[model samples]
Target: MRPRGIFWPGVAGIASGALMLVALVVTYGNSPDYEGRNGLRETVEFYRDAGNRDLTEAMALVMLAAGLLFLFFLAALARVTASRSSLVLVGGILFVALTMIATIAGAIYAITASHTEAFVVTPGTGTVALLLLDVSYAGTVAAMVGAAVLLFAVWRASRTTGAVPQWLAWFGFVIAVLCLAGPFSAWLTVLLMALWTVLAGVVLVLRPPTEA
Candidate 1:
């Protein structure tokens, strides 16, 4: 099997994660004193000023595209585990799709916070700045959940040597968990996820062929 739609969801996932890490750097550079900004208007200004809005927005879109690819990869992987049960396979696909939507939405909303704006940003009120942060928070959470479930689906695929590699499966699991804490250390999450993609590609290439 040529792995159907794409041969590199895991790789895509890792690359997208790296973009986010870069976005974080771009965002942090612009965010002056987060704690000191006590007004709603100021907060918005802070994020826009701290980040290269254009770069951050473009990166956000990239993250969304990568998330979508990851879901497709999960679907291809699930086929190896479903064992002829169309119901299980369909359900698995649904889960991946839902995760994709959630993650994309989150990345878009979250990344928008990092851009150039004329307003001053502060942490005081429920302003646009705060809202963007909240959206990002929710989005990251959704992406994390999706990754966890996708890992399980792929694990089932990895049950036999002909489908997925056991080590690669484990690697994804670790990366999924690390992504959850990306806000704390985007660089760390990006590194691990990058390793996951490379390992996944190697696994897919090495998987034993199944009877047609």
Candidate 2:
């Protein structure tokens, strides 16, 4: 396909990353610290506020959109890299799937905390919320692992055959390494991925891979 053919996908990829950043800002900008010693309590308290619950729901929707847009970018990547390997596609699919699951878990947490009065009145309900939060965190870890694999695949393909630039591949490789740390380094991964996705999008728009 011509560069023109990939242009829209590239733009969509840019949107995907931008949406992720937007969602992060919306959810975390004024949110309470849920990573503190009393993390569960903090989360429960935050969601107790109606505004916080609304914001969580909105961000969850945004995240879902971002994940969908990312699939377009992933398909483009597979084409440009000429990667027949199922792992490349699988990795991308895994990231989206796990991320969707994580987002749903978060949304459920918000609902549980806000709508279910018993969540605060009863210990059992609170425990259920806590378990949901754990599921969200685990999903994030698995998603990042999948993202790391996808990035590694890109780096490997770009080493010689893929149309992507070597520098981008190297950057992806580094990000993939960081991604291995999963939730521990997720913040850094988000920042790096935003940059990488934008750069990759630009490349695809400007210079699509051609058959040799």
Candidate 3:
């Protein structure tokens, strides 16, 4: 937790991004019916049946790595010569907690994928419909909530002009807002989320602490 150097967080962020990119490639062009769409059933099956579930699960696990890296980064940040009770601490806690929650959701999604595999074999249209609908509801709620909490943490950090940049926090806050509207626009929300992640990671990696 002792502050090693500002570059350490950058290293961790890059490492996390590497792991995530791998997961993304593995799951590229693949996703499960864990979320239901009126017409996305066939599309979902194509991904799962193409032996892409592992890829999806791998992506899910990357979140665990991302969470750990951030944990270390935050720990180091917490050791800075400032108020330990500063917004940085709150932001750190939120990131850690929400990342863990997201990790859990990923685990659940992997388990559910197995069930979908079997359902694929039997071709149970009615059952598949129900499962997809259920996933849509549960997954959206989990993702939205976790993302919101993480973004809020960034917003919390934003208050500490020394520890975290205001722009990064606002970006995160906007992404969180987008995520809140997932029922109406999940794709847009995800796009914004991805953008926020990249921007924040970069900022955290490069920003130096301000003079108190």
Candidate 4:
């Protein structure tokens, strides 16, 4: 396919990145940390409000949309890579899968918390909620592994075929490395990924590869 095919996907990637930032902001601004044991207590207390649940559900929906858009972005990159699309496909699939898992896990926690009557605070309720939250966070980190793989694929393709500029391709390498630190840096990985996707989108749209 011609590089022209990348235009819509590149646009979608930019939108995805914007939505990701929105989701990140909503999450941090509206929700409790939900990190440690104390965070669990905060989560329990915070979700007592119906408004919080509504906002969380909205954020989850936004994130789901972002995930799908990111997939479209990856598909465009894979199309450009042609025969080398396999690695991109693998990585994108894994990334989207984990994103789904993480979003669902968080949504379930928020949804469950909304129904105080249905979700009575048993002695184990807090622990279960905490586990769900942990799963969401850990799932995000695991998803970064897939993102790294996808980026590495992009970097290799760029190096071989000059699909993208050398500096931007190396920036992919930098973002991939930052992805590894997702576990330690809260939503820093999300921020970097968003920036990279936006930049990639602009590059793809403005400088269509001659060979792809």
lDDT of 4 by residue, 13-103 (tens): 8888888888878887887767755886787776766788888888899989988998888888788766568988898789778977987
Report the number of clashing residue pairs per model: 12, 0, 0, 0
In the range 91-169, model 1's lDDT, one tens digit per residue, is 3345345434543443343353443243333444225545555555454444445444555555555664435567777
Off by over 4 Å in 3: 1-6, 17-28, 32-50, 74-120, 124-137, 156-162, 185-187, 208-212
Winning candidate number (TM-score): 4
Q: Tell me the alpha-carbon RMSD of every candidate.
A: 5.7, 2.9, 5.3, 2.6
Models sorted by lDDT, best on top: 4, 2, 3, 1
Candidate 4 off by > 4 Å:
115-117, 121-124, 208-212
Q: What ranges in model 2 sit over 4 Å off? A: 1-4, 112-124, 208-212
Give the per-residue lDDT digits (tens) of candidate 3, residues 117-174: 5544333543454454455445544555555665665576446534456676677677
At residue 66, candidate 4 shows an lDDT of 88
Score candidate 2 by TM-score against the native. 0.85
Q: Which 10-residue span in candidate 3 carries the lowest summed lDDT?
A: 121-130
Instruction: Compute each candidate's TM-score over C-alphas.
Output: 0.58, 0.85, 0.59, 0.88
